[model samples]
Every structure is written in C-alpha cells, then in structure tokens.
Target: MPANHRYSARTAFLLLACTVLASCGGMGGSSINPVNWVTPYKIDVIQGNFVSKEQVEQLKAGMTRDQVKATLGTPLMASLFHADRWDYVFTLKRQGVEPQSYKYTVFFKNDQLERFEGDAMPSETEFIAKLGKRRKLGDVPVLEATEAQLKAAEKPKSATASAAVPASVPAGAPPASYPPLESAKQ
Candidate 1:
C-alpha cells in the first residue's frame, strides 16, 4: 500500500477508536462541551441594601417588637434560641471587587436596637426610607473630593470666609408647620 494510504488508514483507525471510546463513555448523552466552558463566566451579584440611623432612631427602645417589625420590615437572620432577639445581617461577596461590602448588623435587644456595632447599620435603614428602596453605592453619598474641588477648597482660607448660608427656602415655605392647626373662623 502507498505510504499516503497507510497514513490515511492510521488516521481513520484513530478516529474510529476515539468514537468507540466516546460512545462507551456516554458522549452522546453528556452535555460537557470543552469549547463552551473555555471562556470565563462573569458572575454578577447585586445585593439589596438596608436602613440608616435617622430612620431607625424613630424606633424607640420601649416600642413593641411589632412596631419595630413594621418600621424595619423583617430581620434577615432571627435567633433560633429566642424570637425576641432580631438580627438584620447583610453579607455580600463580589468576585473581583472589594473583599466585601460593609456588613450591616442591627441587633435588637428585646425588640429595640441595642448596640450599633457597625457604621453600615444606620445608613442602610435611612437609605431605604429616604429612597423608598434599599441603598446602593449611588444612594450612598460620595465624600471623595474631585481634584478641582480639592484645589479650590485647598486655596488659602480667605479672611472673609463665605458665610455658611442656610438653604434657600422655596416659595410658600412655611415658617413652622405643625400638625395642629387653628381654625381660620376661630
């Protein structure tokens, strides 16, 4: 036989052997495709957020557990030992981002927030109430001053520093609005 024919025959035999081995190994039923798995999949996890101190401060220490529940919705991880202790635990993990988003824990002692162990606790609640949704990075105010702002602010303090003007009151702004109102007829 020609050398080329022998080479072709060997290739054919190798392919046939592979096909037989594949069938025995359940290749037809298997869904593991190497080409499909080659590319790395980007896993994105958008975790929900929490409330802030101001929003939760309205919740008093003596307030019933129900009231707290009503105000803050529900705790994420309740104590298995006692129902009274409520733990609002938040844990987030991103692949290449910061090691973590700050863990916010609101521990309620006898249904009232006992100790604010984390800075993230207060902001989460207030953020939710203010935005009518959980807080995101955009919701959280950024304090990192831009280069221009830093330069402007860094300028020597003017002897006549600009007065810290109060916010502008809009038209029809009330002097002091309260719940109780005197009848105009009276």
Candidate 2:
C-alpha cells in the first residue's frame, strides 16, 4: 500500500475509536471517570443522653446521687459491680461530619456526689449551634384569627351548602310524610 494511503486509514480508525470513548463519558451508568455522586441522605445516630455544660456545672461536691441524676438525667452506664461510679457517655455520628463522644463520671460516697470528671462541656446554645442550627434572621410572624373570623368559621354550615352527599349515606328510606306507594290499575 502507498505510504500516504496507509497513514489516512490509521487516522480514520483512531478518529472512530475517539468518538466511541467520548460517547461513553455522557452515559448515565458508571462512567469511565473517577467521580462518584455523593450520598444525599445520612442518618444522624445519637446513642446516649446529651449532657450540657450547665447540667455538669450544677453538680456540687455534696449533692446527693438522686440530685445528680435529676440534674444530668440517667447515666448511660451504671454497673452493678461499681455502685459508687456513674458513667454518662454521649455520642453523635453524622454524615460528612466528624463523630463526637463525651464522657462524664460521677463518684458517689455514701450516696452523695463526691467528685465529677470529664472534658470541657458545651453550653446549651453552643451545643445547639455546633449541631448546625440555622439562626433566625428576622422576627417571626404571629398568625392568629380574630374573634369575629373565628366565630364565623366555627358556625355550622348548612348541609345544602355543600351540595355533595357523603358516600356513607344509605340509598334507602323516604320521608314518613310522603304519600304511601300504591299499584296502578292495569
């Protein structure tokens, strides 16, 4: 074959192969590209009671175990073997965000809170903010009906006004005042 003709045939084959590969990129199924769609939904797992800083700060060295329970709610782990120790653990696992775990221990000596230890606690507002709460930008609208409007709405409407009988109503039965049915003479 002539050199020029051979080069042309090779170019045509290469062009066809390039077009086929380019079409694959637009396919809906898994493409040759490395990119993947991010998951739209992820469950937020919360295993234990969330303890705030204020609740922890309320604890005093002499407070009774019952008071501690009331202030911090029930402990996540209260073992039978360790009667004096109460452990409160909080864990949150959210998608695309780092998991968080907090541990607090309370020791009771004669049913009184002897001491408590844990990491630095977050306040109610701080914790809420950290959980990705959107702050209100402006005053919220208060929607309420006036007395007259409420009374009008509360008034019973006539059956004829609806003009549509419910399907539950039986087809039988004419009024007692209606004339009695009699057979006509043939």
Best-fitting candidate, scored by TM-score: 2
lDDT of 1 by residue, 1-186 (tens): 999999999999999988877665665445574434455755646454454565456665566667767776676666787655665554454444443343444455656555434444545555346334332555667879999998988868554543442347554577665765866675
lDDT at position 160, candidate 1: 56
Clashing pairs in 2: none
Model 1 quality (TM-score): 0.36
lDDT of each: 0.58, 0.84
* RMSD vs true structure, all candidates: 18.7, 10.0
Task: State TM-scores per candidate.
Answer: 0.36, 0.57
Give candidate 2 misplaced runs (Cα > 4 Å): 1-35, 38-40, 133-186
